[model samples]
Structure formats: structure tokens, C-alpha cells
Target: MIQSCLTIRGHLSKSLTTAKLINIRHAHSGIIDPLQLKPLQQEGGLLDKLISAIRRRSAPAVWKAYTDLKDSGKIKEVPIQYHSMTLQSFRLNENGYYSSDKLKFYKKCISDILVATKKAQYKLDVRDYNVLLRLYGQSRDWKAASDCWNEIKVKKNEESYNLYMQAAVQCKKYDEVFKIFNKMNNDGIQPDVTTYNTLIEANGRMGNVTEADKLFRDYFAPKNTENKSTSIISKYFIKDANLSTYTPSAAPLSRCIPPPNAVLSPTTDTFEALIDAHGRKKNTPGLNYIYKTMLPQYDIKPDLKIYNALIRWYCHSGDIEAARNTFVDMEASGIKPNVAVFNHLFRHEALKRNRPKVAEAIIDYMRKEYGIRPSTSMYATLIRIHNKHNREDEANRLHTIYKALKSKKLEEQ
Candidate 1:
């Protein structure tokens, strides 16, 4: 009997390990593999199933598990951490504005769990609020984000306002951005670099060039202007900016902006925003000046993002040679290009110039140098390019290879 028990235990251990691997893989793909749930179910119970489902990162799977547990009256058996884990899973899964529905579903989960917490008198913490705030920001649900902001009972911090402002920017509510900034000042919360960066981006995006430039000069510019005071409040709370509508006490000379915190050095994001502003307006001279001259003067090392911006601007301005040179310089600078960079290059060369060879070279270079596997879009684009040029054999061969790789990936999952 002892030997038999040991043998069973060994098999169970292997099964559990296999199950964990499957759970992790499938969860990342946003779908739980039903076959992998057996081992976890046998070893544990509802919580284990819920955990496995959350690992799949599928909203429906998690909600199903949650509902199952709740219906079976076993939800109370699940620990608070499990609920928090679900919240965190949702928070971390936010890739961007593209996944708004999933984010809304996650928001619902948060609301349901919060109700449960309240009923059970489970004490919530700031991280919970932060995660919810991040979700709201990513979803661009300005009203929901505002509600979450106003509902925070604890002392509001810079991060809270930053998230709110981020959501407002996504909604293009530039007026709301200033209102929040003023409220932050009134609440005694000093705006940080992130605050200023988001505000600048919002203004630039709305074609409010004057606002963006004023903020840049007042805060991020290497040199200070005579008309603008160094104080944050004086610069932002001026009568002419119409920000005083939010705060009656925020007069032109109200001294609401906090004192300068040392000699402010602009972050990489500051330059990126400036460059984007110019790029959007097709102000190539201003964009080039900032990229070449202003950044070096501030001793700011240009990263891949800056390089990508320059490349994109060049591409837009019909300077393919300059864009190619910038791309080479970026690689030389030890800043590796991400898939987005490659995609930008591929799209530009293939669609704009109809030179599919450039894109094909990019594919080879990316694969050889970075060891980065071609994504589905990459394969599709290559096939399309070949077909467009009447290279039917090459297109078919690429299609076959893509299918084989996709089948293998599915098998692995």
C-alpha cells in the first residue's frame, strides 16, 4: 500500500506540473484550455479552477469560474487574494485602447468584487484603487474614471490624478485636463514630470499649439522665458488660459503653482511629445531641430522611441533616404528596433514605394539580427507583397510556412 501510494503521488506531481505549464501558456493567449483543468480540479477545488481561469486571462472564463463558485456557495471559500489576483490580472492585461470591451468586463469584475468586499467588511487598500484607476485610464472611460477618482476616500496622490488625466486625454477633453490639474494644485498635490507630459500631449493633440508651447517653455524648455514665472501655479493658472473657471481662487497672480523643484531636466517623454507635436503639424524643420539640436543640448540620450519618431517623420516627409539613415543610426546606437519599427518600415516601403524588396530585407534582417520570429501580420504582408508582384510560387511557399508555424503554435498551446 505504501509503495502504491508513492507511485500515485509521483504521477500526480507530474500531472500538476504539466497542468501548471498548460495553464500559463493558455492563460497568456487569453483562453483557458479546458483539457488542462482536470488536474487542477482533482488536486484543488473551485479556487484552483478560478485561478487557472484567471491565468488564461479570458474574461468569460474568469467570470464563468467566478459565477460557478458563487452559485455553488463556494465563493466565500475563495480567499480575498484570489479576488485581488483577478483584479490584477485584468489590470496587467490592458495592452492599450484596443481592448476596451475586455477592460469594461474587468471593470465589472472589480465592481462585483468590491461589493463583496464591502458586504464582508474586507479592508481594501490603495493598490486596489490604483489598479482600477489604470483600467479606467486604459479603457478611456472618462466618466467611469472620473467616478473612480471622486470615490477615492483616501488622500489622493499624483498617480491618481495622472491616471485621470490620461483618461481625459484619451477622450480629448483638454478642458477637463486643466480642471484636474488645478484641482491637484488646490489639493496640495504637486504635479510631477508625468503630469506635465500628459498635459503637453493633450494640448498638442488638440491643435492647441499655443498652449503646448507655453507649457513647454514654462516647464520643460531648457531656458526659462521672462513673461512666464518659474512657479507652476503662475504659469498654469493665468487668467487668459481660462483655467481659473474651475477654481475661483486661482487668480492670475494667485501663487497657486508650487515652487520649482530644483533645475528641472525634461525626460525622454517631454522630447517625444514635442517631436510628435511638430510631426503631426508637418513642421519638419521644428521636428528636425528638436531631434538633432535641442536633445543634445539638454544632454538627453535619444532612445528607440525618439529614433522611431524621426524615422516616421522622415517617411511622412517623403525622405526615404533620411529615414533609412535614421534607422541605421538607431541600430548603431544600440537601441534595438521593436516589431512596430519593422512594421512601420515595411508598410512604408511596401505600400508607399511599392518596393516589396525593402520589406523583405527588413524581415530577413529582423529575423537574423534580433532572432525575433515573424508575427502573423509579417507573414501575411510578405505573402501579399509576393502575390502583388506576380511571384506566385514565393507567395505559396510563404503561406505554407506560415501555416506550418501557426499549426505548431496551436499544438504547443
Candidate 2:
């Protein structure tokens, strides 16, 4: 009996040692970390092949490898990690700019994978559906997003609802937003702050000011009680804007005093949405209403986005002076300008071409001051502008510079 016990212990030790040796071999072969970039030469089995395919951003290759393994009886069930990595690869392929045809192809790839997982009864996580929902939203394919919503076997959470709401809103399906919200409430799920913000932004996007205001007043308004006196005006505004309540800044109104006794306060993003909504509709009065009344009550400072929105509205209004003043105010507030701000100025110059020198100067300032290398779109626009003005020489020179820059980038890669 003692000898048998000794033999069993020896065998267990041998199995562990073999595993260590195999891991060491894989490590030396440079396929140790799955998450890191695989070596130029990777040596492993089906999992290694799948990772390689994912790293290459070949959804077709990934799908084929997965199926081949499944058919060969090597992998009985698709691992959750495999699904996640594959989805991540799809997201990587998104690459910021995708044509409608490319988007359609990506959607099909995801749908096929989802169908396979469902057939195998492999439980899907919300993350998987969330990616698909976002893609559908981008593609404006609300029908597929709705179908995905029904495919979830597990109870949905706030994030799931948010994705669906965003998808509906992206497609301008305002009615669908309310429908999903109602379903969420019916399921006894409480809407988070994001849910209300999305609803407000969606309504504001459609110029449904009255509806947006009602939604805001219903959900985000401070809770009231019979014991204390509460005024409707006070809910959205401070009694007075005192200097003591202000944070000192060169810009106009750095911060305001928040209202008292508010349980759920609206965030800066909420007011940004409101401002954006009014801005889109050219309802300057509505923007003033939020800036002077609603924002002060919430103590939400106008951040870079708010300033950009104001600048954009003014630019669209052809009030370049107003836009310039807003840009100065943004700088005064100590918020450094981003590429968006510069792009707006560039776009204005592209359209007007009144002062091509001003556009060139702005580009210089962006490059020298902020170190913002102009994007390809910016160069293209400038070149087109020069061409429009019959400055073929200038256009050709800029085109040459752009090509050289692009070549440098590729060589670096």
C-alpha cells in the first residue's frame, strides 16, 4: 500500500513537470502571451491559429478556423474568451471610417458568429450584444438591433438598455426609444442618469424641445416635498449669481452654485446635450435659457464641448466674429483647443476662402502651439480650397507636402 501511494505521487509530479516543460517550450517559442502581438513565427494548435487570425483582423479567417476546429471535434464548445477576442478584432477593424458596404459585411460576420454560438447553446454576454448593437446603430439598422434585443436569454441590464436606446436614437427612431424605456420600467429596472441624458439628447436632436423639456422636468428635476417651499423657477436657477459662488477665471462664468436639496443632479453632459439641441435648432434663446437658468442651478460648467457647440452654432449663423469671440473665451477659460476647434475654423475658411492666409496661419498656430499635426482630411480640404481659387501652384505644393508626410508615416510603420 505504501509503494502504491509512492507511485501515485510520482505520477502526479511527473504530469505537473511535463506541463511546466510544455509551457516553457511555448514561452521560448514566443507564443506565451495570447493578448500581446504574436511573434512573426507562431507555433501552436487551433487556439493559436484563432488568435493569429484575430490579430490579423480577418473575420473570415477567424470564422473559418473556429468552424474547422468545431467540425474536427477539437473544440466541443466555443469558449467565451474566444467570442470576446473575435468581437474585439471586429471592433479593431472598425478603424473610425467605414463605408456602408464594409459595415454590412462586419454586421454579417458578427451575426453569423452569434448564430453559431446560439446553436451550441453557448451563453452570450451583454458585451457581445453591446458591440453588435452599436454597429447596428452606426449602420442605422434598427431592425437587426431589435432582433438582437430579443435574442438575449438572460435578463438585460442598464447598459443593455442604453445601447438599445442609443441604437434607436441613432436611427432617429424616437418612438422606439420610449418603447424600450417603457419595457425597461416594466421589467422593474431603474433608469440610470445616462438613460435620461440619452432621452434628452435624442429629443433635442429631433427639435422636440417641448418633449425634451418635459422628459427632463419629469426625471431629473429635484425631488420636492410638502414640508418646504419649492418654486419651479428655483429648481432651474439660483436666486442670484453671486461673485462669491463663482470660480475666478478670465472666461465668462467659470462655475455656478448648485441648487440645494437636490437628490439626483444633472451632469455637465446633460446640459451639453440641451445646449446642443437648442444649437441645432438655432434656438439661441433656448441656449441662453439653459446657460443662464438651468446650468447655474445645476452648477455645471460649460466645458470644451459646450464651447465648441457655441462656436459651431455661431459659425453656421455666419457670425464669424461671435465664433472667434467664443474661441477666445474658450482659451481664456484655460481649456486648450483641440483638433475639432481648428477643424471648424478650417471648414469656415474652406467655404468662404475670403482669407486663405488666415487658414494657413491657423494651421501654423495649431502645429506650433498645440503640436497638432493636421489630418489627411484637413490637407485635402486645403488643397481643394486652393484649387477652387485657381491657385493650382499652391494646391500642387500642398499636395506634394501631404504625400511626403504620408510616406514618412508609412516608412515609420
Candidate 3:
């Protein structure tokens, strides 16, 4: 019996060894799998530098040796300062954004470098804001963004103001969003519908529904008989530009305005983002504020996005009934509910029976008011509930329900 077992083991080991040899040969022949190397666009940059360092900057002698430094001729064409900035700012994890682990490392490395060098103290420029805020937002470090703003706002520029708003939201800084908005206005930058919307949206994120609602009415509403800060927008956006700088042609951060009245007319896209963000943050009060203040004042009305934010927020808040109610409210207010709002309802708020009749009401509203079809997420949630309760039949039936929804969707298409 022992001899038979040894023979069998020997044969199995040989077979496995053969397979490994074949794989090695294939790799050497350049028949290697395509997935092994990431797509070309995703490669290059930081990884290239690391590879060079790992290879000791020595090539096969057939290929050119890799070097981190720029060639003399190439260096001549580029501006010295910008080039240094680009190199210094290059993350070792170029596009490590695709992988969460790598991104965390990338952020940590940058933070370490910043702290170790105390670079923030020496140079706090717009480009620096761009890099840091982008990193912070990507990591949802909103407070860091706000702290960065506190350091720079007194010497603030318009670009920093815009970025600070985004970073603040990522870090969940509702108050800073408004604070920066107010500061920007006091600086004489014109506030538009988008700006007002972001302010309201940030407040909503904290579930400060009342404060969000009140602030919107008082500051953002155009005809907001209540808003005391309507002029705050125009006043702050241009404040420093008008009084401090004499060179308006220079970027605001340059603080090099030629004369007063240096007005910056930001595009409508900024305002649209505010609207979308409000919907995301579920700041219903902010939405109302925008409806009253921006529609007539800036001629900006609520779009699908504004409604989507409220609905999605309600959905995420796990109030299926509230989500559905908002869906109805938006339609009544003349806005349409989109697929995202529907998806979020199932994803975030899908609780089952004995919880409340809220889920049913939302489903009913979606059917009756919008005529929009339910999605897989809703059915899946039902399946989850059924399984949790050990109701096999109900879970099986929920699968059938999903199948029916899928079929109907295909038919309509």
C-alpha cells in the first residue's frame, strides 16, 4: 500500500512540474496573458519611475537606460518652476486610484512627505490646493480641506474657493461650505444658483433639516423675503479683487488686480453641480431655498438632479416612505425622478414588513405617479428580508418578481 501511494504521488508531482514548465515557456515566448500588464493608458507615470529605480537605472544595454532626471535639451523648453512642481507632485502610485490599498498608501506617503518637510508652511499656492484637496476629497478628508482653506482663505483666490467647496463636502463640512461661500461673496465674487444650492446641500447631509431649511430661506432664496445675505454673494466674490488688487487680468490668487471692479463670471456648470450636490446631500431646505431664490433671481429652476438629491438622500436615510414621498413631491413640484433615485431607494432604505408601510407606499408612488418601473435592487432587498426570516417561498417568489420586472424592461426597450 505504501509503495502504491508513493508511485501515485510521484506521477502527480511530475504532472504539476510539467504544467509550470509550459507556463514559463509561454511567458518567455511573449505569449503571456494580456491581463498581466494593465492596459497601456493605465500604465506609465509613477510606476515607470519606480521601475527605473528598481532596475538600478540600467537597461539591457539594448534598450536605453531609464533616468529620473530630464534630458538637458528637453529641460530647456520647460519652465523651471512648473517642471519642478510636476516632478515633486508626481505620486509614486500613478493611477493607484484604481486600487483602494494603493490609494491609501499613496495618500499616506504624501501626508508623510508634507509633514516631514513642512511644505505647507513654505508654499501654500493654488496648485498646492489642487493636489492636496484632490487627495483629501478622494480620501473623503473634508476637514483637512477646510483646514487647508482656513490657512489660505485670507489670501484666497476664486479657484481655491471652488475647490474648497468640493473638498468640504467630501469631508462632510456643511458649515465650511457656507462659510467659504460667504467669504467668497465678501471677496466680491458673484454667487450664482449653484453656490446657494451647495450651501443648502451641505446642511442637509448632516440631517440638519431644520437649519438647512432656515439658511436656504434666509440667504439663498432670490425672492426669499427672508434671506438677509442675498447681497452676500455679489459682495464677497469680488471683495478682494475690487479693493486689494489693481491688476484684474492676473488670476485672483495672484492678488495682482490692475484696478477695482474685477468681476469673475463663473459658468452655469458650477451652479448645476450645486444643484446635483444638494440632491446628493439631501438638503431639502436648500432645495426649497434654491427654488425660491435662484429660479427667479438667477433664472435657474430645479432640474431632475435637484429632486434626485432629495430622493436619494431619503432613500439612503432608510426612510423608504420619505423617499417615495419626496419622489411624489418632486413630480408635484415639476421635477422628474430618474433611475438613480429609484436605485438608491432599494440600495439604502429597503427594509421589510413589520417595519412600516413605507416601502409599499414608495413602490406605489413610483408606479402611480412617475410610471417608472422598479429595479433589481428593490427585489433583491425583498429576497434578503425573506431569507432572513427563513421564508423560502417568499424569497423564491421575490426572484420571480425580479424576473418579471426584467422582462418588462426588455419589452419596453
Q: Which candidate number maximizes TM-score? A: 1
> After TM-score superposition, what is the CA distance of residue 305 in candidate 1 from its true location, in Å?
2.8
> Poorest 10 consecutive residues of model 2 by lDDT?
1-10
**C-alpha lDDT of all candidate models, in order:** 0.65, 0.64, 0.47
TM-score each candidate.
Answer: 0.67, 0.65, 0.42
Top model number, lDDT: 1
RMSD to the true structure for each prediction, in A, is 11.4, 12.6, 18.9
Against the true structure, candidate 3 has what lDDT?
0.47
Error of model 3, residue 119, in angstroms: 11
Tens-digit lDDT track of model 1 for 34-138: 323334454257767776776576666777887788788776655444554455455543234344556667778778877766654544444566677777777
Task: Evaluate model 2: give its TM-score.
Answer: 0.65
What total of clashing residue pairs does each candidate reach? 3, 0, 29
TM-score of 3: 0.42
Tell how far residue 151 is off in model 1, in angstroms: 3.4
Residue pairs clashing in model 2 are none
- Model 3 over residues 1-413: C-alpha lDDT tens digits? 00010111111121234345334433442112211322222223433343333224222210121122232222222222222133233322212333355447546655544542343233433445555665666577766766666666435455556667756776765556666766776788765444544554564455433334444444434342444433322321212222322112212321311212332232244344444435444444444444455655656555565556555655544456666676667778776676567666645545522431345456667778778777666777777776878889978877897889888876964
Question: Lowest-lDDT window of 10 residues in candidate 3?
Answer: 1-10
